[model samples]
Structure formats: structure tokens, C-alpha cells
Target: MPGRTRPIDKLAAAAAKCTKEGSVYGKCIMADYNNVHKDKCITEFLKLKECYLTAYKKR
Candidate 1:
């Protein structure tokens, strides 16, 4: 199982969203989306502090 490759199907499902230009899995470019994502994609991107909920009465 060492040095194995990942299946493409698993990547497709794991992707949060894709470029709607019929290029769902088109280009694999390096991007500096750290800032752009949090600002432009605010509605979807979750803030770091917002993810912690230890004191909310555990289920």
C-alpha cells in the first residue's frame, strides 16, 4: 500500500466546489487564495475561531 495513487472519484466528491466553466477539474494551478478566499468567498469559507465549540454542551 506504500506509494499508492489516489483514485480520481474520491477527489471529485471531496472537492467543495469547482470552476463552473465546464472545467470542473481542469487546471491545477498554484494560487494565493488564502486572503481572497476568506474575503471573496466569505459565505462559504469558515473562520478558524468559528470552528471551535468545546463549551457548547457536548452532544
Candidate 2:
């Protein structure tokens, strides 16, 4: 799986990192499918979203 990748991989990897490093934003992103943490981490999520969008556009 060295070169393997997927759309959700970024988010999933951040979520895993959150588990180890205790990132509330990561937890919010990982579990807030319902937007419960929207107000709390909107800026962080937007940054992550921008990264995801940039990567998506490359492929």
C-alpha cells in the first residue's frame, strides 16, 4: 500500500492522528457527519477541505 490512496484517506489519516495526538478538530471532522462541530472547527475544516480539493483536482 505504499502508493495506494483514496478520497477519504486524508480525512481518515487525520482522524487516526487525532486519536494519538488528541486533536478536537480531527475528532470533529471524523465524527461530525451531522455538522455538530461545524462552529467549533470551521476554519480548520476549511483548511483541510482546501487541501483535499487541491489534491482531488490533481487527479
Writing each residue's lDDT as its tens digit, candidate 1 over 19-58 gives 2321321221114434343245333232321222221212
Tens-digit per-residue lDDT, 1-59, candidate 2:
68878748765654444333345457766775665633677776666666555555555
Off by over 4 Å in 2: 1-24, 27-37
**What is each predicted model's overall lDDT from 0 to 1?**
0.31, 0.58
Tell how far residue 54 is off in model 2, in angstroms: 0.2
Error of 1 at 28 (Å): 22
Model 1: colliding residue pairs: none
Following a full C-alpha superposition, what root-mean-square deviation does model 1 have from the true structure?
A: 11.2
The estimated TM-scores of all candidates read: 0.20, 0.41
RMSD of 2: 6.9
